[model samples]
Target: MPLRSALAAVLVAIIWGLNFVVIDVGLEGMPPTLFLALRFAVVIVPAIFFVPRPKSRFRDVVLIGSFMSLGQFGLLYTALAIGMPAGLASLVLQAQVVLTVVFAALALRETPTRSQVIGVAIGALGLIVVGSGRGAETPALAFFVTIAAASSWAIGNVIARRIGRSGMTSTPLAGLSLTVWSALVVPLPMLALAFALHGSDAVGFALTHLTVPQLLSTGYTAWLASLVGYGIWNTLLARHPASAVVPFTMLVPPIGMTTAWLVLGEIPTIVELGGGVMLLLGVAITTGVLGSGRRRRLRS
Candidate 1:
């Protein structure tokens, strides 16, 4: 990957890392399902009117929106609300990296190199260590839901790779337009889901009683995380192999853990920290940054 695209991916990681803290704070005052509804509602508004749809097929856009927006965020918010800690949630969701690689290989024929496979295995082991330390604390339902959220995000990544390969324009502006327009397809289904889960009364109550922090969380997630983060992310995926782009997401947990500590005052356990280190090392290996020089030296 180019340095610039790498930087862009890092930027998205930072934004998303902090996003868990923001969601946790937001959920303090709002119902989870309702919070999701509001976030997507903010995502698609007057802005959707201005952002032209991407040249991708309507079905592609809908699938992307459903998985990325509705499935991922909806399940994630509920998991946090139900009892998953912000720091742990961040780490667990990195499971999507493994899932993405699998889906990309099966669906897109983007086979992983041996090094990539090794890295993913290391990362999965790290996740196991982290989960062993923290698993006793989180609710079973919340834990399973978070796993489901990760699966949803992985599916979305594959769909994004598919869209990129299908010849959609991927200029930065087009990327932003795609993000916003794809988001436009989410609100109705999300709202209906929110209603089905939480009921219309709960949704109305949450909306009427919106706190400032909740509103800010909705805004940040809509504009910064969804629009800016996903826009840059989709652009990178469009230009690179899914394996190359998806490994950048491994940075998210470290950032997420740190931000959760700083903002939410949730400290990590010693075991979790060790796991985090292993996770970062795995990401470096998976991206070929950690072992590239040695590999080239051996080749020479």
Candidate 2:
């Protein structure tokens, strides 16, 4: 990947990392489903009118929204509400990296390089270490639900790759347009589901009780994380292979853990710190920053 795209990936990771903490704050005094409804509601209104639709099939747009927006966030928010710590949620969601690689290989025929395979292995080990260190207070149901969320996200990543390779979009800018349009498709279904799952009365109560933290969290997630973050992310995926882009997400767990500690006072244990270092090292290898030079020398 080019340096600019690499930097863009890192930027998205940072935005998404801090996003966990924001979601935790936002869920306070709000039902998870209703909070998601509000976030997507903020994402679509007004902007949808100005942003042109992506140059892809309508079905493709719907698929992106279903998996990426609805499935991913729906499970994720519920997991957090049920007892998943924000920092651990961040780490567990990295399971999407493995899933994306599998899907990309089978669907896109984009084989992973040796370094990437190795990096993923190392990252998986780190995830195990981090998970083992999770406090007993965390619920088993939350952990499994988060795993489902990661799978949903991985499926969404594959769908995105399909869209990018379909020749439906002519340019990277079209990718951003697609992100906005697909996001527009998410809110209605999500709102309906929210009502279906958590009665209208509960939804109404949460909406009426909006606190400052909730409002700010919704705004940040809607504008910055969903709009800006996904916009650049889709653009990068359009311009690069899935293998090149997805590994950058490995950077999120450490950043998420750090932000959680600083903002929420959730201190990390020594095992988590060790796991974080391993995760970073894995990302470095996967991104070609650490091992590429040695590989090139050996090849010569």
Candidate 3:
């Protein structure tokens, strides 16, 4: 990647890293479902009308929405509400990279190179180390929820790579509109599920509560974080390759931890920091960010 693109990737990284904190802020005054509804609603109104659609079907739009919008964010926020620590959740989200690699090979039938294979193995080990140290002295619902959310994120990443082939990088703002529509549409079935299984009180509680900060945060989450952030990311990767962009995402966890610590007064653990370093190293190796010119050419 060029210096400018690298810097752009880093900027995206900071926005994404701090995104967890923003979610915490947004959720403070709003319930998750209501917050998400408002968030998607903001993206879907005028922007959907103005934004051009990708070269895909309505189902593809739905799939993208499920994977990127609902699968990723929905599970993540739920994990936080359930029991996952903010800093740890930040670290756990990085697991999506490994999941993406696995999904790409399976879904797209694209085999990774030798370096990437090595990178994946080393990265998996690092993740295991980090996960082993999770502060769940006992099994907690939140820890499990966080893992489920991260798994969904991985699945979503595979779905995103599928979208990349559609020739619509600039349409992310449009995609957000499309994604929000899908989010609004698909969760209806789940609404029935939530009512039948979880009952009216849980469903009703998540729906009725509202506050200004939460509402503003929701708009910011969808419009700024999901729309603007993912928009730049899609554009960058469409111009480059996943290998070029994903490495910088490794920077997100460190920034996330830092933001959580400074802003939320959460303490950072040594294991978490180490895992973050290893995670970045794995990404660097996978993406050829630090290799020499000859080696970089060889990898390419």
Q: Lowest lDDT 10-mer window, candidate 1?
A: 168-177
Q: What is the C-alpha RMSD of each candidate to the true structure, in Å?
A: 2.2, 2.5, 3.5
For lDDT, candidate 1 versus 3, the one ahead is 1
* Local accuracy of candidate 3 as per-residue lDDT tens digits, 179-261: 44455543554455456655688667766765666766777777777667766666665556565666677778888888888
Candidate 1 wrongly placed segments (more than 4 Å): 170-172, 296-300
lDDT of 3: 0.67
Worst 10 residues of 3 by lDDT: 172-181
Residue pairs in clash, model 2: none
Query: Which wins on TM-score, candidate 1 or candidate 2?
Result: 1
Enumerate clash totals for all models, in the order shown: 0, 0, 0
> Model 3 misses residue 279 by how many Å?
3.1
TM-score of each: 0.91, 0.89, 0.82
Against the true structure, candidate 1 has what lDDT? Answer: 0.82
lDDT of each: 0.82, 0.82, 0.67
lDDT (Cα, tens digit) per residue for candidate 1, span 1-300: 789888999999999999999899999967776778778788778778878878889999888888888899888998998898898788888888877876777888877889889988887787777666664567878877887999999999999888888876545476777787778666776678778977888888888888899888989998999888998988887788776888778778878888888887888778877886776667667667668768889999
